[model samples]
Target: MDDKTAELRDIFLDATGGEGTVTERQAERRGSLVDVDDPETVDARLRDLVATMRERYDFATDLETDAYLRLIRGFYGDETDAALADAVGVDAETVAWARLDCHLVRDRDRDDDAPDAIRERAVAADREATRANDRFRDAFVDLLTDADLSGRLTSDSREDGLREATEDIETNVSL
Candidate 1:
């Protein structure tokens, strides 16, 4: 394989949890369909792999994932929900819900209230804020600005970093 093809293949492999090198489990399931000479085929497979990754990780639907990925990649700077949605080709509501699911954004509520009510309130507040200031629009941006976390999520170390972060949060759980 040429350098570029190898690199792209490695990227998709890692993105789909292959860790640069295919695992025995993957071989069992996918059976090594990659063709180094066929870059287009590889690209198609990579796209499919990314779709599967998005579904498995629950990163939001395809539109939301595209938007979130753009935000994380720094393509959109402090954009409001509508702007981001337009940029990503999804609705503002989809972006809003994805932000919450990704844990990289939150609304303006801190009271210790019932979970459902708090969520509803936060969503309503976020939607209104988006419509009003547009600055207050869906994503807060800074929530996932930590370099370590962002680096991990953007690179091959995503699973490990996520695991560590989750463990840290679990340890810090007060109750």
Candidate 2:
């Protein structure tokens, strides 16, 4: 194979968690009906292997696996769920639906959608719910920002001798 073909094969293999070898085994076991040279055939076989992995090992669905792979490859950004879904050959709706169906996503009750009698009670409940959501959001944002800042600060400190400044602060705080 050429360099590009070899690289693509490596990527495909990695995405399937090294299951390309398993695909070869399955093809051998099935007496060579599969044509690995054909792109369509290869995709169909890989899809089947993905399904078998899900059925046998309780692995994530193909869409979820694709999302994870994209994230790991830095192809998906913080707010690019739609792009990730598109790259994975699935829709954003399907990603959400699968997450909800698998209980990986939670459903929140909204007061605006409640009936009149329930609306009043729900409004009160929503106050607490909204507060909780705000707290969670704040915490999540803090974590992401802290992680990003830490990475940048580490790099900058190493480059500009700022680590000594941080050490000085640490020493003063400890006194």
Best by lDDT: 1
- Candidate 1 lDDT over 1-175, as tens digits, reads 9999999988898787966554455445443313322545434543443354455444444453344555433322456767767777777666665544433344333345436644664565455445545432222322223344456556757777778878856454666
List where candidate 2 sits over 4 angstroms from the true fold.
1-64, 71-76, 98-150, 155-175
lDDT tens digits, residues 1-175, model 2?
Answer: 9999999999989988977565443444442322333446534543443344345333234455445334322221354546656666777655443332222222222335534533443344345336445442343233224445667877897877866766657443553
For candidate 1, report its TM-score. Answer: 0.30
Model 1 stretches with alpha carbons more than 4 Å out: 1-60, 73-76, 109-175
Clashing pairs in 1: none
lDDT of 1: 0.50
**Alpha carbon RMSD to native, model 2:** 19.8
Give the range of the ten consecutive residues with the poorest summed lDDT in model 1. 136-145
CA lDDT, every prediction?
0.50, 0.45
